[model samples]
Target: MMPRRLILAGAVALGAAAAFAAFQPSPVAAREAVVYKNPQCGCCKGWATYLQRNGYKVTVIDVEDIEGIKRRLQVPDNLHSCHTAMIDGYVVEGHVPVEAIDKLLTKRPNFTGIASPGMPSGSPGMDGPKEDNVVKAFGPGGIRVFGTY
Candidate 1:
């Protein structure tokens, strides 16, 4: 039989490994994010860069009519932003935080998508100090607060 001390040490190591894994980003291959923005938008590029830093495999496509993509995605007019992204079959609008994105992916809520709404200051792509943002989930059911950051 294994020594009692060895058993205890092994258990501790296993627990530590599990906890570390939980904090790491989920499978990267599953986190492909496609961002669509107007050709002239630099803020949109900044937002995409932020997503890349947070473990998303980001692909950016510059289009002439950003509104066309928004409309095609069925994003609400009120929740519109400078850029839009699609990840795991969900639409992410604006400079939404990674925390909210994590929640959306984890919960898999039935909704059109989540949005920070408008070009809010301090959003991932925007300049200025970090500001509290009201993230909303909008769909056929209507809009509701998802989280605040």
Candidate 2:
């Protein structure tokens, strides 16, 4: 027969494994983020910090010319931001909310990515209030109302 302590330890280990398995995020779920912005831009830094605070793993790249990056990526003029980022395969522009990006990744929507448009107030880097900003998602076609937050 097994010792009581050994039986308890085995039970605990099994329970812990079950919990970890149950709590694991889906493979397709989005978790990490990467931001590309001009090295001199303070707002871009603030935005990266914001993403970090919200449980995102952010990689920041200081670029010489954000416009060049934007043009190379083919981001539309109206969906422009001070900085541009690529997370997973989608292009995230401006101070887009992390939650929106989460949804986009989970759903794997048929679009390019989310854009807040021209550094609107209350965005990630641009601070004010959640209500003060309106972020939109864009695609090859045009802008679509993804969400306000």
Q: Per-residue lDDT tens digits of candidate 1, residues 6-41? A: 999999999999999999875655489999998899
> In model 2, which runs have C-alpha deviations exceeding 4 angstroms?
1-30, 129-131
Question: Model 2, residue 39: what's the lDDT?
Answer: 89
lDDT of 2 by residue, 47-118 (tens): 999888887788999989889989887788988989998888999998888888889888988888888888
lDDT of 2 at 80: 92
lDDT of 1: 0.92
Residue pairs with clashing backbones, model 1: none
Q: Which stretches of candidate 1 lie over 4 Å from their true place?
A: 1-30
Alpha-carbon TM-score of each model against the true structure? 0.80, 0.77
Error of 2 at 37 (Å): 0.5
Show the lowest summed lDDT stretch of 10 residues, model 2.
126-135
Residue 42 in candidate 2, Cα distance off native in Å: 0.9
Q: Distance from true position, residue 106, model 2, in Å?
A: 1.6
